[model samples]
Target: MEKEYTIRELTKLCHETAQEKGFWDEKRNIGEALMLIVTELAEAMEAHRIQDQANFKEELADTFIRLFDLCGGLEIDIQEEIDKKAQRNKQRPYKHGKIC
Candidate 1:
């Protein structure tokens, strides 16, 4: 069986890999990092548009990796934030009071 990693673990792993690859050799530009993640999502959208299942899945993974790396670099506790947001969302009305 494969080992399961929590979101925090994945964050650490992704950040460590990025650092090892010299992504952190110098101070990073937050805007550029964010845009790169957006680029990955765009790639995923293109893959989905063409029904390229394999590439679509890979691009989705890339998105998460980039997000995790960002969270780790900033020392943000993503799991805790997710839990807090989810709890708050649970108290909201259907669709957060939105139509359509």
Candidate 2:
């Protein structure tokens, strides 16, 4: 069986790959990375609009990879933050402030 990688490990790999590809060179700003993340989300939205399941899945993965790359670059613990947010969300009322 293949080894399962933790979120942190995957993120580190993304960061390394970005560096190797010159995507994180001195000329590029963090805002560019953020923009790429948003672009991936837009692609996902377009895929969903057309009901393209394969593209939707691929775009979602792209979004996550961009996010993970950013988080890895910033030295953020995304999994830890996710855990904290999940615990906090559990204390909220049903449906919270949303109408639906």
Candidate 3:
């Protein structure tokens, strides 16, 4: 069977791993952390462009790992925020009033 974890659990796990690896030994630069996540996504995009399915999937996972780590480090309730944003998005019109 596959392992299952909630968003909160994953956040904790990711953050703990990062801490164990000494990534959190110092106060993190939030901007740099966020950029690292963006870089992961950019890598995923490049992987997709080149049809590297394995790398694309790995990069996508890296993106989420970085994001979850950030949220964990900052004590942000990312799951709650996502739920709230999803609820708000559900109330929006198609295309969110944009043309094109």
User: Clashes in each model (backbone N, CA, C under 3 Å)?
Assistant: 0, 0, 0
TM-score of every model?
0.97, 0.85, 0.96
The weakest ten consecutive residues by lDDT in model 3 span: 91-100
Tens digits of per-residue lDDT for model 2, 69-97: 88988889988898999999999988987
A best-first ranking of the candidates according to their TM-score comes to 1, 3, 2
- Taking the tens digit of each residue's C-alpha lDDT, what string does model 1 give over 1-100? 9989999999999999999999999999999999999999999999999999999999999999999999999999999999999999999999999998
lDDT of 3: 0.96
Q: lDDT of candidate 2?
A: 0.89
Query: Cα lDDT of all candidates, in order?
Result: 0.98, 0.89, 0.96
> Between candidates 2 and 3, which one is better according to lDDT?
3
- On TM-score, who's better, 2 or 3? 3
**How would you order the candidates by lDDT, starting with the best?**
1, 3, 2
Give the runs in model 2 whose Cα sits over 4 Å from its true position: 97-100
Error of 1 at 96 (Å): 0.8
Runs off by more than 4 Å, candidate 1: none
Q: What is the lDDT of residue 54 in candidate 3?
A: 100
Please provide the root mean square deviation of candidate 1 (C-alpha atoms, Å): 0.7
